[model samples]
Target: MSLKIALFGITRDIVGTSVIELPAPAPATVGELLAEMRRQYPALGELRSCAVAVNNEYANADQPLHTVDEIALIPPVAGG
Candidate 1:
């Protein structure tokens, strides 16, 4: 499974990269993906809030995933 995810802001800091591949035998849904991410990157779990997008649209936890889908992780942003 080759699901690539783009990361922004603090998510990048937590993951130490702007993009990452979902581990082999990819998650089937957004929630599963998040759980797996927190497993691999515990720092990601510390964030109070984060947003996930699939194919450029805001996604829900139950949203299905596919190897072809475009994914992104958005961390909460503070407006100055």
Candidate 2:
């Protein structure tokens, strides 16, 4: 399955793009996708924290992913 991921903040910087296409296996989970992403872009793992959103809602590690789902990578944010 092919998943489209929208990148934000430091994630975009690390990936060097606003979006990325990842080839994932069927029945993949958010956690699995994250691990694959970390494998491809080790910099992503350096962040203090990150979140994955599917269809505009935060996804859990066990959340199942679909190819047609709207996915986004939200990096940690800091404000003064």
| CA lDDT, every model vs. true structure | 0.87, 0.88
RMSD of each: 1.5, 1.8
In model 1, where is the ten-residue run with the lowest total lDDT?
70-79
Q: In candidate 2, where is summed lDDT lowest over 10 consecutive residues?
A: 21-30
Clashes of each: 0, 0
Clashing pairs in 1: none
- Model 2, CA-based lDDT: 0.88
Those runs of model 2 whose alpha carbons end farther than 4 Å from true positions after fitting are 24-27
Q: Give each model a TM-score.
A: 0.89, 0.89
lDDT of 2 by residue, 1-80 (tens): 88899998899999999999876453389998888888889998999998899999999999999888999998886768
